[model samples]
Target: MARRNDHTREELREMALASAERIIAQEGLAGLSTRKVATAIGYSVGALYTLFSNLDDLCWQLNERTLSCLMAAIKEVDETDPVACLQGCARIYQAFAEQYPERWRLLFEHRSNTDNPLPDQLSTRIGGLFEHIDGCLARLYPRIDRHERQLRSRILWSGIHGLTQLEHSNKLFLPDAMTAEDIRIHLIDSLLAGWDKESHHA
Candidate 1:
């Protein structure tokens, strides 16, 4: 390892996070540990503790990056119509799960090693994702009041995540059936139709 003073605390923190991400991507969360991260980052376990409270904190930070990456992907869909934009973002989300299956699973599937709730900063990042969806749904159907729209966005997000999890588990289809992408698009279309009708009655 290089001399301890070669890197600042902030730089060491970044290095540790990057190393942890690489380990998780290659070996899933099962392969992550403070020891492994410290070894890869050229810092001792003691040094790592200076950066993160514990493994869970590092995990939350990694997941925050994953959320940012996902939000960036969906925002780049480049659709003009609000309905189309929302649908396009769904497709983008589907692709993201395919591209980074482990990272995607880590965000939702991995259980915490402790009982502590996520930190306030990380919790805000998670909520911001739903808020993004809330905005999109509001734009698509302005009659769907804010409270109602927020609830709907959570439902929509959960449904898509469930579908993705099923796909990863190799249980998305029969011998001959619509692909996962097809099913996702169909699900979105059906939900949008129902939401549109619901808005009129609001």
Candidate 2:
């Protein structure tokens, strides 16, 4: 290990987070522990606790970073057309899962306790993702009222999420063997078609 003074507290915290991410990616969240993170970062467990309340706190911070990374991915989708943009968002999400399976899984699967809920700030950050979809839906159907846009956004997101979960779980057994991307595009296209019908009816 390097000399204790070689890194400041802020640097040590960054190191610990990075090391914890690696451990989770290789061994999963169940395998993560403060001791492992401290050892990897050349800091004592007490030193780590000085920066974070506990392992749960550290994991929560990591989850926040993960969400930020996902938001960045979604933002990078270059399409402006509502349907294509939404489809691109789904494709980017699937790509993120494939590229960082462990990190992505931690977002949905990690829980400190079954009864305890996330902190309000974290919950709001998670909700921002839904807002991204809501914005796109609003652009696509400008005449739809805010309540209807919110409802449609939630419904479309659920469909995208369901498809992603099925793909990740590897239980999407079908005779035709459609890939995840294929299913994502089909879902978005079908939803758009239904929305068009609704708009015409209104």
Candidate 3:
């Protein structure tokens, strides 16, 4: 086993995080432990402590990296057509959730036991998710006010998230009727069409 001094603090931090992610990916959040991470990185638990305050801090950092990956994935989608872009973004989000359920759950399902709110940086990064959706809505409906657009983004995301949980639990009305994405497509189209119809009637 390599001594802890073999690597710089930053390198050790990265190594620990990577090891932790692999452990979590295979066994879910409950499987993660500071000792496991330390052993995986060939370092002592004390050395791991130097990198993170506690397990919660480690999880927080893990979630931060996951969020960055998600945002980058969204940015990679072509946005020439806002409508298609919106649908593409939705699909990508769903794909990410399905591919990395444990990581995705770590972002949301895993919560710190502390009473203190999350770091402002993390809170702000989470807000970016909703803001991205808001921007997409602006392109689709120029006349929609910011407040309304923000609310719409939340509503749309809430629906998608709800369906995702239901899908995973096999709790949807029709067990094998359709995928969450299929229902999401119909839901999005119906909502968009309803808005267009409302405008016409107005």
- Alpha-carbon error at 80 in model 2, in Å? 1.9
Global local distance difference test of model 1 = 0.82
Against the reference, the lDDT scores of all candidates come to 0.82, 0.83, 0.85
Q: Which scores greater on lDDT, model 1 or model 3?
A: 3
What tens digits encode model 1's per-residue C-alpha lDDT throughout 149-191? 9889988988888887888789876457568878888888899
Segments in model 1 whose C-alpha atoms lie over 4 Å from true places? 175-177
Q: How much does candidate 2 score in TM-score?
A: 0.90
lDDT of 3 by residue, 82-107 (tens): 77777888888888888888888888
Find the 10 residues in a row with the least total lDDT in model 3: 169-178
CA shift of 178, model 3, Å = 3.0
- The per-residue C-alpha lDDT of model 2 at residue 137 equals 90
Cα RMSDs, all models: 1.7, 2.1, 1.8
lDDT-wise, the better of 1 and 2 is: 2
Q: For candidate 2, lDDT tens digit of each residue in 23-138?
A: 99999878899999988887788888987888778878788888888998898876578777898888888878878888888888877853556867677778888888888898
